[model samples]
Target: MSFLSSNPRLTQNEGLAPAYNSQSEQPFAKPPVAIESYIQDLIEQRYQEQPEASVVCAWDGDFTYRQLNNLARSLVALLSAQGVAPEVFVPIYFEKSRWTVIAILGILHA
Candidate 1:
């Protein structure tokens, strides 16, 4: 099933941020089982846990988690400002790269 099929809240465009974080008193009751369910959260955590880790490599060179998060956040701000909404289809055609990953996370945030 699609994330849109499972997460009714997607239609309402609520809870844009990750469900749990270091500041939370209690753990998020259910960590998203499907990798696609909470990609922004997962990527953010991965960056915090290991920012220097190599997450991408293209003709330009290697890209680290920190770079990916930074790119995604930038994309998020642009996309959110453009009124991108949850569960809405957005066509992003690009070859696989750190940038594409960033776009996915940004779309999630949007």
Candidate 2:
């Protein structure tokens, strides 16, 4: 069956709001997940298993974790030279391209 048909009640106006609300109300609670360290641990594990695996790939080329890290560092340096601070929200308006990917990675690394 199609997704919309499977959840037929959602198609009705009265059924829409509470069905959404019921999904969100969970009595049991779990510990909050730490995402940053989790991501770092996964990266470390991947590097340990296959040091040559690519982390970031673009239309121009594939960049390994080490290469992306180095590129990010260099871009961060360039951004620093232009007086961008750690907390500053620099608006990046650009057409989608490899440079945009590099800029995003650079910002994350910074």
Candidate 3:
């Protein structure tokens, strides 16, 4: 999905930023699982916990967790329609940006 079409609330700056810090030590509710499983669960958990929270802050705009989840789901559907499957090498070549994050999530979910 195009950035503009997927997230209409995206605005210039507005002092948006991720609510959490990656470098900070965080506690988990449960013991750690495998990387793949953890990532999938984490994505869903974030969406559930705070759908409107900013997950990606790009030059164009900040993407909320809900928007990211929706965009990723849309990409997953597109990939499935194109016969994409597990272990398939889906090369996503985009400059470091929000779309890249969405693509990665799509590939993983697909």
**TM-score winner:** 3
Tens digits of per-residue lDDT for model 1 on 39-78? 5677778889999999878775777998887887888789
lDDT of each: 0.74, 0.67, 0.81
- Arrange candidates by TM-score, highest first: which order? 3, 1, 2
**lDDT tens per residue, model 2, 1-110:** 58667776653344447765655565235556667664445654675677677876677677776665567679989988888887888788887655675687677555
The model with the greatest lDDT is: 3
Question: In candidate 3, what are the lDDT values of residues 25-69, reduced to their tens digit?
Answer: 344635666575558679789899999999999886778999999
Residue-level error in angstroms, candidate 1, position 87? 1.9
Error of 3 at 39 (Å): 1.3
Clashes of each: 0, 0, 0
Provide the global lDDT of candidate 1 against the true structure. Answer: 0.74
Candidate 3: minimum summed lDDT over ten consecutive residues — where? 18-27
> Order of candidates by lDDT, top first?
3, 1, 2
User: Could you list the CA RMSD of all candidates, in the order they appear?
Assistant: 14.8, 6.3, 14.4
